[model samples]
Target: MSARSNRQIVLKSRPLGIPRAEHFEIRAAPVPALQPGQFLVQNLFLSVDPAMRGWVNAAANYSEPVGLGEVMRAFAAGRVIASRHPEYPEGALVMGMLGWQEYAVSDGQAIRRRVTETDLPLSLSLGVLGLNGVTAYFALQELGEPRPGETVAVSTAAGAVGSIAGQLARLRGCRTVGIAGGADKCALCLSEFGYDAAIDYRQPDLPDALRQSCPDGIDVYFDNTAGLISDAVLPQINRHARIIVCGTASVASWDPWPQGPRVERHLLNKAARMAGFLIWDYEHRYEEAIAHLAPLVRSGELRFREEILDGLEAAPGSIADLYEGTNLGKRLIRLADR
Candidate 1:
C-alpha cells in the first residue's frame, strides 16, 4: 500500500453463520478527493460488534446487507484531515459509519455526532459514550424500567452493554443478577460489574441455577442472548416484569429462524411485558444518554471495559472472536492515534 493510499477491509463473500477472516479481504485504494458538503477522516479506531454479523448475512435485517466488494460497514472514530463542509471543519474529531478503512469520505449524514467530550479519550466515542453505553441506558431504563427492590437479571452480564445495564440496575437499588457463559465471566459479573448474583449458562442445570439466583423472580430481564438463556429466564419472571430483548447473540443464523420454547405463555401467565430495543430508534436522545453517562464515567461511579486490537488487520477476525466470547468488553481495532 502506498503512503497516500487508503487501506480497507472489503466484504469478500457472505457468511453462512458467524463471519470469519476468510469472508473479508484487505486492499489498498487511492484516497478520493473531497466533494462539496463532504469531509475526509483519518480513522483512529474501528469498532467490532456482533451486529456486524447481521450486516453481512444474506438474510434480511433492520439494515441492508453490505454488498460484496464494498468496504465493510463499521463504526469508526477519527479526526477530520480535510473537509469541504463547514460543520465538519478540518481537525474536528468525529465518529460514525466510517467503515473498515484507514480513511473515509463522508457527506456528514453518515456522521453520527462530533466528539465533544475532550476530557475523555476519543476512543470512548465508539464504546462507553457511544452506541454501547447509550443502548444500555435506554434499553434498561426506558424499556426495563427497573425499580428499587426489584430483581433485575441481565444475560451476557459481563459484556459491554449488559455490564453497564447491570450497574445501572444496581444504582437504582435493584438486586442485579448476571448470567454469563463461563466461570471467569460469572466471576467478573460479581466482582467488577456489581451483580448481586452470577449464573454460568454453560452449566447443564441452567434453569435451576437461574431459579436459585433470582429467588424472588426477575422483575426486569435485560436479555442479550435469546435462545436457551432466554428459555431459562422467561420461566423466572415475576408479575409485571419488563423484558428487554437487546441482542440475539446465542442464535447464529436468523435465516431459518431458530425455534425455541414458546414465550407467550410465560408473558401471559406472569402478565409481563416484552419489547425489542433498537438503538437507532432512540437517536434523537443520544445526547441525553451521553450527558447522563459521561459524568458518571469521569467520576468513577460508572465503570466499563474494552479489548482493543492494535491495527486494522485485526478487523476481519474480530467479529468472530467477539461471538466466541473471547472479548471481555467492547472490542475495537486501532488504525491510528486519536
Candidate 2:
C-alpha cells in the first residue's frame, strides 16, 4: 500500500575507494502497489559482498554499476508477502537481486531460485549455499582443476569464497594453503577451513612464509585478492598450474589499472593457465552446484560463518566493514526473520 513505508539505502554517488556511509542515503518511500505479473518480497536477509565496490563504481566491471540515486544492488533471501503472479505465490521463499531495501518487487526475472531446502538456515542462501559457495564450487573444481596431492593456495582465505575453496581443495586431496589478512583469520583457515597451512599477508615476511608453507610450489592458485597477494603467488607457481581470477579485493580500481610485475615470464616457465571466472556465466548449472554443496554444508564437512548485522540500517556500513576486514566470514544484514 502507499501508506506502507519501504526503508532503502540508495547509492548517492560512485565511490572512489572503499565506500563510506556518506556515499549512500538511507530513506523511506511508500511501498508501491503491485501491478500484474509482479510479486512483493519482504526481504529477510540482505547480502553484503566485496564485489559491491565494483558494482557501485562508475568504471567498467563485470556488470553495470549501480546508477546514482538507485537502490544499491545486492543479493537477498526473502518471502513473498503479496503477488499478482501465479508462480510466485504468497509465502514462497525466493532468492534474488533484491537490492538494499526492506522489500523488493519482482516479475521473477532476477530470481535465482526458490529456497527449497529448509533444513539449513536461510541465511546460508547468501553464503556457502549461495553465490559465494557456487563461485568456489565451479571455480576450484572446473577452472582450477586441482589434482590430488597438489598444492592449492587461496587468497583472502578466511573470506566467503576463499574459505570454501580451501575446504573443497582439501576434500579433493590437495595440500591447501590459505593466505589471509591477520593471525586470527590465518588461525581460522588452519582450524576451521581445513587448510593444511595458513599465511598472513600482513606479516612482513610473507614471501618467506609462503615459500615455507608451499615449498613444492602452488599447483592451483585461487586468487581472490589480486594485488600484492597474487604478486607473491606468481613466483611460486609450479609447472602446469591453474590460476582462478575470481576477485580483486586488494586493489579498488581497475580503469587506469595499476601496474604490477609481469606474469608473462612466470606463465612461460611454468606452463600455467590463468583465467577470470564470473558466476553468471554458469547460471545454468547452479542447481548442480547447490546439489553438490548443500549436502557438504548440511553434513558439516564444509564449515562457514555468517557475520550478521542487526537491521536494514546496518547495510551502508557493511561494505566498509567487508573491505576493512572487520567481518570474519559472509557479511549479511538481518532485515526480518522468516
Candidate 3:
C-alpha cells in the first residue's frame, strides 16, 4: 500500500514583527508509522491565537519561540486515528499543542487533557471550554477579585478572552464596561456579552469616552491591549483598583517598546495594583476551572463566538488578520470534520 501523507505547516523563519504567511512553508510528507507507545492524531481544528506572535518572536517571553524549520506551534483538538499507546486509543478526542498540521504524532507529552464534554461542538474545545475561558476564569477570580457593584472595564471586549471575562464579571455583580474597536463590536458587547455599557475605542477622544462611560472610575481594569487603551483607562481607575494585564495586542511591536503615557502617577494616585497574568501559571487548576465554566457554558450563561477558516493553508494569514482586528471572535482553522 502507498504510505499515508501528512499536510503540515512549518515555520520557515522567525517573524521580524507580526508574523506573515511568507514566514511559513506548507508541505506534504509521508505520515510516520507509529512506533510502540506512540499515537497519531488527525487534527480537526487548529487554534490561532494572538499569543502566537510572541511565540514566533526572538525576544524573551514566557515561552520559547518556535524554532526555524519546526511545525508552527498551535493548540488544537483532534481524534486519535491510530494508536499504539494504551492511554490514547483510536477515536479518543484530545486537546493539545498539536501545531499547524493535518496530523500529529504523539508520545503523549503535549496533551493537555482528553475532551469530555460531548454536548458542544468539538471546536469549542479551543475556545470557551479551552484556554480562552480558562484564562478568563482564573484571571478574574484570582486577580481581579471583583466586588458587588464594582466597575469592571475590559479592553478588546469583543474578542474571545475579553468577551468571556466581561460576562463572568457581570455574573459576579460588577457593572461591566467593554472597550472594542468599532461600533458593531461595541453593540455585541452590550447586547450579547452582557456589558453594562460598551465604548468604541476607535473614537478620537478615548479618555473622554472612558470618563463618560465609567463615571465612578474603573474598579477592575481587564487590560488585553496595553498601549493607548491602557493609557486612557489608567487615569480613570478608582481607589484600590486591580489592573489585570492579559495581552498587548494594540501595540504593533514590543521589541524596543513603544513610547506612551507613563502610569506611575495614575497608579500611585489610585493606590491601584497592576499585575500580569499567564494561564499556564494555574495549569494545575484546569479541571477546577472547567468544572465551574462548563456548567455556565452549557446553561447558556457564558457565551462565546468563533471565526473559523477553511484549511491549514489559512492558518498563517489568520494570525496576521487577528492582529489587524479583522477577526470577529476566537479565530480557528477547521482541518476536518469533527
The residue pairs found clashing in candidate 2 are none
Misplaced by over 4 Å in model 1 are: 1-3
Q: Where does candidate 2 stray beyond 4 Å?
A: none
Model 2 per-residue lDDT tens digits across residues 1-338: 65779999999977897788889999898889999999999999999999899888878577998999999999999999999999999999999998999989899997999999888889999999999999999999889998899999999999999999999999999999999988899999988998999998998878888899998999999999888889988999999999999998888777677789999999999899999999999999999999999999878999998888989778887898888887899988998888
Off by over 4 Å in 3: none
> How many steric overlaps are in each model, in order?
0, 0, 0
TM, every model: 0.98, 0.98, 0.97
Model 3, range 1-338, lDDT digits (tens) per residue?
11888888999988877999999999888888889999999999999999999999988589988999888999999999989999999999999999999889999998998999988899988999999999999999999999999999999999999999999999999999999998889989988899999999989999999999999999999999998889999889999999999999987677677898888888898888999999999988999998999999889999999998998879878889988888788999998998
Cα displacement (Å) at residue 287, model 3? 0.8
Distance (Å) between predicted and true CA of 175, model 3?
0.3
Give each model's whole-structure lDDT: 0.92, 0.91, 0.92
Q: Per-residue alpha-carbon lDDT of model 1 for 1-338, expressed as tens digits?
A: 12479999999999998999999999999987778898899999999988999999998689999999999999999999988999999999998999999999899988899999999999899988999999999999899998899999999999989999999899999999999988899999988899999999999899999889888999999999999999989989999999999999999897687998999999999899999999999999999999999998999888888898998889899999978887898898998776
